[model samples]
Target chain A: GQQVQQSPASLVLQEGENAELQCNFSSTATQLQWFYQSPGGSLVSLLSNPSGTKHTGRLTSTTVTKERRSSLHISSSQTTDSGTYLCAPFNVGDNSKLIWGLGTSLVVNP
Target chain B: EAAVTQSPRNKVTVTGGNVTLSCRQTNSHNYMYWYRQDTGHGLRLIHYSYGAGNLQIGDVPDGYKATRTTQEDFFLLLELASPSQTSLYFCASSGTGVEQYFGPGTRLTVL
Candidate 1:
């Protein structure tokens, strides 16, 4: 079975500060995605970066498939950014079934 | 936008009871999935289907059954449910890509 581990089980940051979350997988993954779950209970798809780097707004995602690792970076974090971030890896030939990380809880203070 | 809708956002059932969680997608995706989220285990895959009238067992399929009857509907069934089955369930849909869109989620509690 494949395992996905996220670093810093939890983190607290001051408003306007930067945050970085790491995800490492035990096996090779053909695709990787980052998702944000808000306190409002909505899970938003952030990025689908299986390899290389991608940026959307103040958020950035970098995935190195060869190393079986991915990272999500938040710049100038805000109070609304407080939530849980999950990383999921899917095997290409497996019908997109995902192996998810427990998630990194991020709290931003005003 | 891709949308996945789940019915009965919250549910409470007793042991040995039968429960069904319904999911619908308006995006017309070919792939649909059901996953359970727990405290420390994250989200575990229960079942998935590539199209209507098809079902595939996922990583954790014991005590769970799934059915996909139409392009827009998928259901998860729990027969003779137990307390251990209590958890938050999510339904997701995606096309050929691996980027999945999740539903609002259903919180199920088996007493």
Candidate 2:
């Protein structure tokens, strides 16, 4: 079975500071997705980057398929960005299954 | 908007009781999945279906059964539930792409 590991299980930062989260997988991945889980536990997809760097607003995701690793960067974080960030990667042969990381809990202080 | 909705956002059941978690996706996706999220284990897939009347076992399918009665409906059944089964359950749907849309989640507690 494939496994996904996220770095810095938890992090806290000032409102204007930048945050970086890392994700590493045990096997080759065909698709990589970043998700934000609100305090109430609702999940929202942030980005899907399998091999290249992608940016949406102040969040950026970079994935290196051959390296089996990915990263999520948040710039000038705000209090509303506080939540758990999850990284999931789809195994090469598994179409409907995704290997999920334990998640990086971020807290943006005022 | 395309979305996935789950029923009975919260549930409480006794040990050995039967519980059913329902999920409906208006996105008209062919692939639907059931996952459970715990404190440190993250999200583990329980079951999935590619289409109506189709079912596939996931990584953690023990003591659980799933049914896809229609393209828009998927159900997770817990027959004789236990306390260990108490966790937040999430239902997700995806089309041909890898991106999956998740439901609000159902918090189930087995007493």
Task: Report the number of the highest-TM-score candidate.
Answer: 2
CAPRI quality band, candidate 2: high
Q: Could you tell me which residue pairs clash in candidate 1?
A: none
Error of 2 at A82 (Å): 0.4
Q: What is the DockQ of each candidate?
A: 0.74, 0.81
Model 2 C-alpha lDDT per residue in residues A1-110, reported as the tens digit of each score:
78889999999999999999999999988889999999878998899999999999999899999999999999999999999999999864975588899999999999
* Recovered share of real interface contacts in candidate 1: 0.73
- Candidate 1, A1-110: lDDT as tens digits: 78899988999999999999999999989889899988766787898998999999999999999999999999999999999999989897655688889999999999
Q: iRMS of candidate 2, one decimal?
A: 1.3
Candidate 2, what DockQ? 0.81
| Candidate 1 CAPRI-style tier | medium
> What are the per-residue Cα lDDT tens digits for candidate 1 across B10-98?
99999999999999999989999999988888888999999999898898999999999999999999999999999999999989647
Q: Candidate 2, residue B103: CA error in Å?
A: 0.6
